[model samples]
Target: MPVYTHGGDIRTAQAAYGGEVLDFSANLNPLGMPDPVRQAAAQADCAPYPDPLCRDLRRAIAAHDGVGAEQVVCGNGAADLIFRLVFALKPKKALVTAPTFSEYEEALTCVGCEVTRYTLDQDRNFDLDEGFVDTIGPDVDLVFLCTPNNPTGRLIDQDLLESVVKRCGAVGAVLVVDECFLPLATGGPGLAPWLASHPNLVLLRAFTKSYAMAGLRLGYCLTANQDLRERLGKFAQPWSVSTPAQAAGVAALTCCPHWAAEGRGFVEGVRPGLAAGLTAAGCTVIPGQANYLLFRLPGVADLKERLLTRGVLIRSCANYHGLGPDWYRVCVKGEAENRRLLAALREVL
Candidate 1:
C-alpha cells in the first residue's frame, strides 16, 4: 500500500503510546463538537441514501455564505473536495508553499501535476510575502494558497493574495484559497468579499476546525464560476458525503454560529497562555493568527520522544518541507488540557 502522512493521525499515536494520550497534534477547536449539531445528527435520517446532489446541505451552505446554492458543492470532507478540484481542473503545473499542508501536494501529484514550492522564510516567522508569486509563469495552471496555513498558523496578507490571484487570473491559472483554518482566527468574512469579482478564485472551507467536527468529516467549497462548480460536481462521486454528515453540515452551519463565536474566544484565550508556557520552557513560539502555534525547542526530536513517553502527542514538524527537526506545532486546547501539555513539555524539556 502507498503510504501517506497527514494530520489528525492520532490513532497511530494512541496505538503506540496507549489510548489516553493527550493530542496537541490535531489543530481542532478543542471544545469538542457542538451539542446542537450532535443532536441534529442523532435525529437525522440514517436509513435512506443521502441526496446525491446534496441539495438541502448545499442550500444551507449557500444561505450561510450568502451565495447562490448552485455555487456550493458538499463533500465527505475538505480533502475529498480538494482532490476533486485537482482532478477536475487537471492543471499541468501548480504552485504551493512548503512547510504547509501535505494534502495539497499529495492531491496535485496524484493527478500528475508538476508541483513547485515557494518556501516560507523561517527566520521571518513563516510570514507570506508578495514576492512569492513573482516567479509564476503563464505555463502554471493552478496556485494553491492556504490561508492561516496549517502547522505554521500564519495567514497571507489580503493585498498580497489579491495580487497573486489577479496575476494568476490574467494567465488563466486557477487560484484555490484553502481557508480551512480561517474560523479559528478572529476576523470578518475574509477573502469572501473578493469571490464575486474573482471568477478564477476557489475557496475551500471545513467544519472540522472551528465547529469541532473533525471526525464527522463535513466540508464544502465556494466558487463564483458556475462552470467550475459544475465540473467539481461532475467529478465527485454521488452521495460522497453521508446522510448524517449532510445533516451535521447544515446543523453546524446554522446552529454553530453562536458556538463559533464562543469557540473563537476560547481559542484566543488559550493561545497566549500556551505560548507563554512554551516560551517559559525556552521554546521559540512563532506568533500566529489561528488556534495553533509553531515553536522551536532545543532538542525537539528528543523532547518529542520524551513527550510521547509521557503520553502527550504533539506534531513534530520535522517531516514538513523546509522545516527542521527542532520545530513543533501545538494546538491551543482548553485550559486544563493546555496546562497538561505545558506541564508535560516543561518536564520533558
Candidate 2:
C-alpha cells in the first residue's frame, strides 16, 4: 500500500533546521498527555503478549461510550482499522470527501477499488452541504467521511450527516465516519448513540489525538453488527495492540473523562485569538470549531520553509487532494506557543 504523508514529524524538522521546532503541523492536544495515563502505561507489564481481542480495553471504551462491549473492536491504531475494513469488505467502488484524510483513498486503492471524490467548495469553507447526499447512489459500495474534517477542520452539519447516513443505508452502501477529532470538538453529540439505529454506520475513534497517545498506536471502531465486528477481527493481525497501549487507553477512558472537555474548552478559548492573530498577519483564516484552523495566504508555497528557518513548523495542505500550496493548517496550542507561532508568521509573512 502507498504511504500517506502526515504531520507531527518533528524529527525531520530538527534534522533540516537544526533547532528546536515548535510544531503546529499535527493537530494534537497541546495540554500534553495526562498524568494518569502515563502512570498506567509505566506500570503496565509488557513481558506477556497483549490480549488479541483487547477485552479490557474494549469493555472500558464501551462503558465510557455507554455501548455494549460486543459493539466495539480495538485496533493498533485508527489507520490499522481503516485498512482492515477495506480489506474485509473489498468494496468495488468508494466515495470520499476530497481534501479529507488520505488513508481512505490509499486503502481503497490497495484493494483495487475504484474511488470517486466529492469536492467541497472552497467558497463554502469546505463545509458539507445537502448536495453531498446526492453523491451517494446504489453504484457506490462504501463512503468515508471525516467530521471536523482534516486540513479544512470543518464539521459536518448534524442534519446533513443524518441525511447522508440514511441515503447510504437506502443504497446499501456502508458509511464509515471518522470521529478521531470529535473528542477535541467543543460541542455536538458523537455518533456512538446512532450505532443501534444505523448498523451500516461505523464510528472510528482514537486516543492518539485526544489523550496525546499518538506513539501508543491505539484506536477503535463501533458498530452494531456482530458479523461486521467479527470480520474486522479476522482480518486484523494477532495482538495488534501492545500491552502498554491497552493499559494507557483503559486508564485514559476510566480516569480522564474530563480531559476531553478540558482540552475542548482550552481550544475553544484560544482559537479566536489564534484566528485573529493569523488574520492580522494577512491570512484568510477558515473559521473552525475543532482544535485546529486552516488558512490561506499569499506566498504560502514558501511560507513553510520561512517558518522553519525561525524554528517553527506548520503543515502545508498542498498534498491533500483539492487543496493547493496556498493552503495551510495549524494546531490551536497554548497561549505562549500560540503567540510564538503568530510572531513567526508575522515575520515570515
Candidate 3:
C-alpha cells in the first residue's frame, strides 16, 4: 500500500530546511495539552501490559458522552477504528465525500470495496446539502461522512444529516460519521445523541486533536449496534491502545472537563484574525467553523515550499481528491504563532 501524506511532520521539514519550523499543518488544540493529562501520561505505569478490553477507558468515555460502555470501543487512533470498521464489515459498496479524509478511501481500497464519492462544490464552501441524501441509495452498503470535514472544515447540516441517517437506514446501509474535529468546532453538536435511534450510525472520535494527545494515539468508536461493535472488536488487535494513552484519555475527560469548551473559545477568538490576515494576503479563505482555515491563493502549490524556507509549515491540499494544488489548510494557532504565520505568508505570498 502507498503511504498516506498527512500534516504535523516538523522533523522532516526541519531536516530538509535546516531550521525550526512552525507547524500550522496539523489541526491540534492551540491551548496545548492539559497539564493534568500530561502528568497522567507521564505517571502512567508502563511496566505491565495495557488492558486488552480498555475497560476503564471505555467507562470514562461512556460517562463523558452519556452513553453506555457497551456502545464504546477503543482503538489505537481514529484511523485504526476506520480501518477496523472497513475490514470487519467488508462492505462491497461504500460511499464517501471527496476532498475529505483520505483514510476512508485507503481502508476501503484495502478491502477491495467499490467506493463512490459525493463531491462537494467549492462554490458552496463544501457544505453538505439536502442533495447528499439522494446519493445514499440501496446500492451503497456503507457511507462515510466527515463533519467539520478535513481540509475544507465545512460541517454537515443537521437536517441533512438526519435525512442521511433516514436514507441510510431505509437502504440498510451502515453510516460511519467522522467527528474527530467536532469538539473543537463552535456550535458543532456531535451525532452521538442520535445513536439510540440509528443503529447503523458509527461515530468516530479521538483524543488526538481535541485533547492534544496525538502522540498517545487514543481514539474510539460509538455505535448502538451491539453486533457491529462486536465485529469491530474481533477484527482489532488485542491491546491496541497503550497504557499511557488509556491513562491520558481518562484524565483528559475527568480532570479537564472544560477543555473542549476552552479550545472552542480559543479557536473562535483567533480564527477571525487568522482568516482576515490570510484573506488580506490575497488568499480566498474558506469560512470554516473548525479550529482551522482552508484557503487558496495564486501559486499556492509552491507556497508551502517557499514558506518552509522561512521556517514555517502549512498543509498543501493538493493530495486531497476534489481539491487542486492552489488550496491549503492551516491551524488556528495561538496569537503569537498566528501572527508569525501571517508575517511569513506576507513575505512569501
Candidate 4:
C-alpha cells in the first residue's frame, strides 16, 4: 500500500520497518477513546440485525447538532458516506480543493466525474481565499471542501465558506463541506444552521477523529435536503452503521457531551509546543487550529523512512496534491508523546 494514501497503517509499517511504531500519522484525539464510549460499544447487543436507517443514532446526533433526526443520515464512516453521496448524485462535473481529503477525488472519479482542482497556495499557509468561491459556477455539479482541512490543518474562513455556499446555491451545485475536524478545532461547529436555507449544502461529521473511535466507524451527514439525504442511504447497504457503532455514537453524544471541548483543549494546549519543537528541530511549521500540524523539514532526505527506523510514524505530505516531498504532518498528541517525537526528530534531523 502507498503509505500516503492514509495514516495509521501500523501493521504495514511494522512489517517493513521491523519494530513497534509510534503512530503520529493518523490525526486522532489526544485524549484517546473515552472509557464510557468503550463500555457502551462493548455491551451492545449483536444478536439482532442492526438498524438499517440508524434511527436512534440519528436522533442522538440531531439533538447534539441541533438538527432534525430526519435531516441526519448515518453511515459506516465519513468515507463510506462520501462514496454513497457520489453514487447517489453521480454528478457529471465536480470541484475540489487540492491538498484536501483524497477520498473526494477518489469517489468522484469512480463516477467518471470530471474534477477541477483549485490548488491552495502553500506560501499563504494553504488558506482558502475568495478566489475559490469564484470558481463555483453552473457548470459544476458538485463541490467538496474541508474545513480545518486534513493534512494541512487549516480552517476555511466562515465568510469565505458561506460565500461558496451561496455561489453554489446560485449555480444549482451541491456543496459538501467536510467538517470532520471542526469539533477539535478552536472554533465550535458551524454551517449546520445553513442547511435550513441551502438545500444543496451537506455537512459531514464523524466520531472517528474527535472521539478516537476510528475502529467503530461511525459517521454521519446533515442536510435539509430530505430527498438527497434519503437518496444517500439508497445507494449503499441498508445497515451502513453496525450495532456497536450505533451504541457508541449515542453514548459519545449523550454521555460524552464535554469530550469534544476537552479534546479541543488538549489539542490547543499541545499544538504550540509541538510546533515549536518541530521548528527547533529544523522544520518550518504552519499555524493551524486543528488537532494536527503541518511542517517541512529543510534538506531532509527519506525523513519518513528514517523516522520509521526509529519507531516513529508520521504522515508524509508527498502524496497530497499541491505539496512537495519535504512537507509532513503529525497529530497533536500528549506532552510525553510530543516530546518523544521531538527527541526522535533531534536524532534523525
Candidate 1, superposed: residue stretches over 4 Å from native: 1-4
RMSD score of candidate 2 (Å): 1.4
lDDT per residue for candidate 4 within 1-349, as digits (tens), equals 3434688888989998888889999999999989989999999999999988788888999998899998998888999999999999999999999888899999999999999999998788999989988888779999999998987889988888879999999999999999999999988467988899999999999999989999999889999998997788678786778999999989999999889889999888889999998988889898988999999987674788889988999988888788878988999999999999999998986
Candidate structures ordered by lDDT, highest first: 3, 2, 4, 1
Which residue pairs show backbone clashes in model 4?
A: none
TM-score of structure candidate 2: 0.98
Off by over 4 Å in 3: 1-4
For candidate 3, lDDT tens digit of each residue in 1-349? 6553899988889997898889999999998899999999999999999999999999999999999999999999999999999999999999998889999999999999999988989899998877788888888999999988998888888888889999999999999999999999978788889999999999999999998879999999999999999999899887799999999999999999889889999999999999999989999999999999999996657989989988999999998999889889999999999999999988976
Question: What is the per-residue lDDT of model 2 for residues 174-251, given as tens digits with 9 covering 90 to 100?
Answer: 999999999898676888889999989999999998988899999999999888998998999989999999999999
Global fold similarity of model 4 (TM-score): 0.97
- For each candidate, give its TM-score against the true structure: 0.96, 0.98, 0.98, 0.97
Off by over 4 Å in 4: 1-4
Error of 2 at 177 (Å): 0.5
Candidate 4, residue 323: how far the Cα is off, in Å: 0.5
All models: lDDT?
Answer: 0.84, 0.91, 0.92, 0.90
lDDT of 1 by residue, 1-349 (tens): 6553555677777787876788888888878888888998889888899889888888888887778887787888899988999999998999988888888898999999999999989888888787777867899999888888877888888788878988988888899999988877766356766778999999999888877888878888888988998889888887798888888888887877666667778898888988998899899888877888999987657666688888998887888898888988888899899899899877876
